[model samples]
Target: MKNNFFYGYSKQADLPEKKRLLFTEFMKNNVKINQADSATLLTGVLAPPAAMAAKKAGESLPQLKMIKNVPDVLFVPSATVVALITVRFSKRLFMRN
Candidate 1:
């Protein structure tokens, strides 16, 4: 039973590297300053390369169009603990911009 519960939570489990990737992607993809005109907020795990790329692009990264301005449309490589941070930090995203 404990294992089952733990397994159920696996989707939310995030490796340190995984969290770093998603955070990096979020910082890279969402560079818009205006809430009304910026891309959707993003969060979650990213493929190793994706994160590396995002880190490379840094603050100069471009915006994405897949999701609307809702912000929940994060580009995660897979499921992770990022949901919590993304859910709340979604609003904080544009502030720095």
Candidate 2:
């Protein structure tokens, strides 16, 4: 339907079954990454239902690999707690500069 978020993609035909899927797509592929406006840079969003339905219909879609959370994450986070990440570089690398 014209109102569908993926109307244009759905209308495409004669494409390789694998390439016809709508998963991750660039927002502005023609724009150079380094030169394009940061605000209009490429982006993509998930349409899981669409992909799943396509797979059920026997269309060959790119295999989606789902990442399961660490098995060690058995304990649920507290309401007031937030997960944090830290990146540490080698002391030798910074010292050389």
Per-model TM against the reference: 0.20, 0.19
The residue-by-residue lDDT of candidate 2 on 1-97, one tens digit each, is 2334356555654565633443234344334565433222211112233333434444333442221221213322221121111011233355579
Worst 10 residues of 1 by lDDT: 36-45
Could you tell me the TM-score of candidate 1? 0.20
**Clash tally, candidates in order:** 3, 0
Q: List, residue by residue over 1-97, the lDDT tens digit for candidate 1.
A: 3334334345546676665666566667767665432323333333434544544455353564333332332433322344444555766776768
Candidate 2, residue 44: how far the Cα is off, in Å: 25
Alpha-carbon runs more than 4 Å astray in model 2: 1-5, 16-81, 85-97
Native-to-model Cα distance after best TM-score fit, residue 6 in candidate 1, in Å: 19
Q: Give the per-residue Cα lDDT of candidate 2 at 94.
A: 57
Question: What are the runs in model 1 whose C-alpha is more than 4 Å off?
Answer: 1-12, 33-97
Clashing pairs in model 2, backbone N/Cα/C closer than 3 A: none
lDDT scores of the candidates, listed in order: 0.46, 0.33
lDDT of 2 at 39: 22
